[model samples]
Target: MIQMDLEQRQSSRFVRPFQVTNHEDETFSAAFEGADVNLTGLGFFIDDPDLFLPQQRLSLRIKNEQTDEVYCLEGVEVIHLRPDDSGKYLCGCHISHVTSNQLLAHHRLVMTDAETALVSMETSKLSEFNFMEDGSELSTDESDFQEASMALNLAVSQSESNQQEVARFVQSVESIFASTQSSDMKLQDLKEEFEDFKQYLGQMNESTIAFATLAKLLAHTPAEPQDKLAWKTLISDFETRFLSEEQQVAYDFMHQGLDADEALEIAQEYLKK
Candidate 1:
């Protein structure tokens, strides 16, 4: 366990008992024995050395446990009077104003025995429901069991869906690679027939059919470094052999149009393989 300073002084301040009632208007009043105190500048603090700011208006109600009387205080702002090295503050406040006999009635209600018993009973029941004993097993209600089962099934389904997507991507890459190989072989066969080869290259360039097919395939497959290197080499070789002076310009433009980041990603993926 982490150790902290245990020598620090700790004390509890017992204020005059009163009951409080909070209202929706971002205000709360404290009632005590038929008098209500309109409090302003109420806030909370901790023993840590960090500053705490209130997100909303501060208000509180104090109740007399012995008399069932309630007191309401409104419009209170908490001021950090003094802070220690550990960031703990000694806080104190004064009531800004008081109004109405309704506050006194509230104070009386809080100091009653019946009110004290009711509050104690509710607190005890809540503690019993929330508290866990040492070595005690967790208990699951029917709703909890159903939620667990649903979550398990959802996870299994998502796993299967991802697997299928990956398999489909792999298949697409293979198909495109096969088509490219076939086209390359055809180009090789027509090499001796210069005129025919030139014509074929022109058609290929005009259609951008092969590059388009490869691009689609690459889009589906995971981009690996090795795959990108191989692709670059293939394109370099094709450019060297079949690209005419004019076609080279078009090819350069098209290459530039492709996203460099995506190309690098494909290369990274190949490196992974």
Candidate 2:
């Protein structure tokens, strides 16, 4: 209960229905045909077959349920996401290029059918990334970055066949990023540490390696010019490295029926190790 606000006047509305398709891999697909609330853009409890990390951006196809009009929203950034007691994941997203306030009237309402679809979809038919389909200037670097995030999310979820190794790798990457963000560490020492571990992830496959790279990309929450360009280059590097590797891990883990606690434990053991 984060104080849901329905009177947001600065953005889009109408409880628009949506379809989230994978931009690169067709493995991941989802939709939202739910209520529209004005919580600074929109929020949906996306029934993602795969878990999405914080700050993930993807192409979102939003439609007015009644009118059947589709609005393609590219680079829809996922601001926040968490799960409830029923093993469902909720994603609060901000749709870009959707600034117009289309709906004139506002009221408290809920799209139970759409919400239910989002909350209870089969995980078997989803992946973690989506890109722009309309051929808009979707950057190569951005797509690479998203691909990396997808890999990390999939590696930790039930869909990853080799969950132990993926979790271990993700934990290490998060630990590495955490070190870089530490205030107590000397700048020179941190640089040296970064240089030492820089190629460490590069040697691994794209998805596992992205665990560190995406952290590196998202390290700048509010994105600066230089850092933005720098991160994009690095994200491209992540894809290149992934393509170079043999990728020993199989890609058959989504909706595999593994216990959530077990998967989470392997991925959360970085600090303890």
Candidate 3:
């Protein structure tokens, strides 16, 4: 394992309220309490350091109690294993391989924790300065104290805003995943409903044409409400389940007046790579 002194740490570690489970070992306990997490790695106590070798990979599930956010990391490489005085080993590991979405969520979680720590640090620093004194020289200039307090308030507000945005993004991604699964389960029913509506529309158009060609040509008829609903559901289901990220971009480009052939060609090239 790569060893380093405490002063050589690359990222600031914080004790956030989150739980982690080691999927590799069933006998490992004390998982619900939480761990020390930073931007890059996690430090958790285990029963034995001898069980883990240098550079060993582990599967872990981390859940943040405050946010109720869960991240299941499939690949994490062990950086070091140290036995503490309590007889338990402190396992240090860094995330190695994870999907794009999971990585994004993990990064956001780390950022949220780091931002909270920073806000706390700034508040503590501001508290150290004596802004008001009873007929005595202030330890810090009043204007300077005001500016520092304002800056701290602004930082706290900005951090909360960023956290809300991250939560919304994660929620939307989860909703899409749920929608995709639900759509797949009802695909056959949706297809049948769409086909039935198409047949009915065709029959009505044929009759309208037979009655009077000119009237039919001039008519601006709206689709039935049920037909519109079915069509919308089918379209949403198709786009969500079948299209890849690259293909969806190409599809949007086609609707925006780009040449269909060019869009298809670009999408194909992306898929090939």
Candidate 4:
């Protein structure tokens, strides 16, 4: 006969259905119904009792049904297994090593269940008190239940506050991303405008160089008075087509008494504006 040891619990057990996947291949890996869990121990029904043995350590991934959160319980050793009336084994297990965060999550779950139980008890007592003919004062148990309910409400409020903080943080990140994206677009537009300005400057430089080359050639080459007159007319037409009003003024200054350097300076000053 397989001896079943009595369960020793340090914390109150809460009925919490969860999917349990066994890390080892020897036992069944499936979701067990009618599972109860505390901070350090778990009890659930299994189809085969013989598959599990006492002191057999197993790693388990437990996913909570209500919260949809998964918890890892390592060094989970089987303590006992007893045959139930429904032809299934009630396997009891103890968690040897549980991290602080994991313990806290389990604690919260247990607290939530305790709160629910207190509410149910309060409802039942209230109904009984209502029907009673005697106008009795509130019992000590009822007062205690109310106090516990208040604590649970406080915990729930804290949880809500934490959620609000997280939401605010996410909103802040989104705002920063939007601002950065806007800056990038502005920078791209500025770059394109700068390129267009550079192209305009390049075309002006090319036109200036062509005009200077033609003027130098006309000054050095021998020509008749008619040829010189025709050349001057061509130059005037070129100035009218390619040069701005400011540039034309500089050219007239150069033809008059002003030196070439002084006329060039005047043209540069006008172009700067």
Top of the candidates by lDDT: 4
Candidate 1 lDDT by residue in tens digits, 155-229: 343344445655655565555555646777646544544555456555544333333322322222213454344
| Structure candidate 3, residue pairs in collision | none
Worst 10 residues of 1 by lDDT: 124-133
Give per-residue CA lDDT, model 2, range 66-160, as digits (tens): 54544444445666676745566657665443221111111112123444323322110111112122332223356444544444564455235
Across 134-199, the per-residue lDDT of candidate 3 in tens digits comes to 222222234334433332333343344445655655565555555656676557545655566567
- TM for every model, in the order presented, reads 0.20, 0.28, 0.36, 0.37
Winning candidate number (TM-score): 4
**In angstroms, what RMSD does candidate 1 have relative to the true structure?**
29.7
Ranked by lDDT, top first: 4, 3, 2, 1
Q: What is the C-alpha lDDT of each candidate?
A: 0.35, 0.41, 0.49, 0.52
Quote the positional error of residue 133 for candidate 2 in Å.
19
Q: Give stretches of model 3 more than 4 Å off.
A: 1-9, 24-33, 113-273
- C-alpha-based local distance difference test score of model 4: 0.52
Once fitted onto the true fold, the runs of candidate 2 whose alpha carbons sit more than 4 angstroms away are: 1-29, 32-36, 48-50, 98-273
Off by over 4 Å in 4: 1-8, 24-29, 114-273
> TM-score: which is higher, 1 or 4?
4
User: What's model 4's TM-score?
Assistant: 0.37
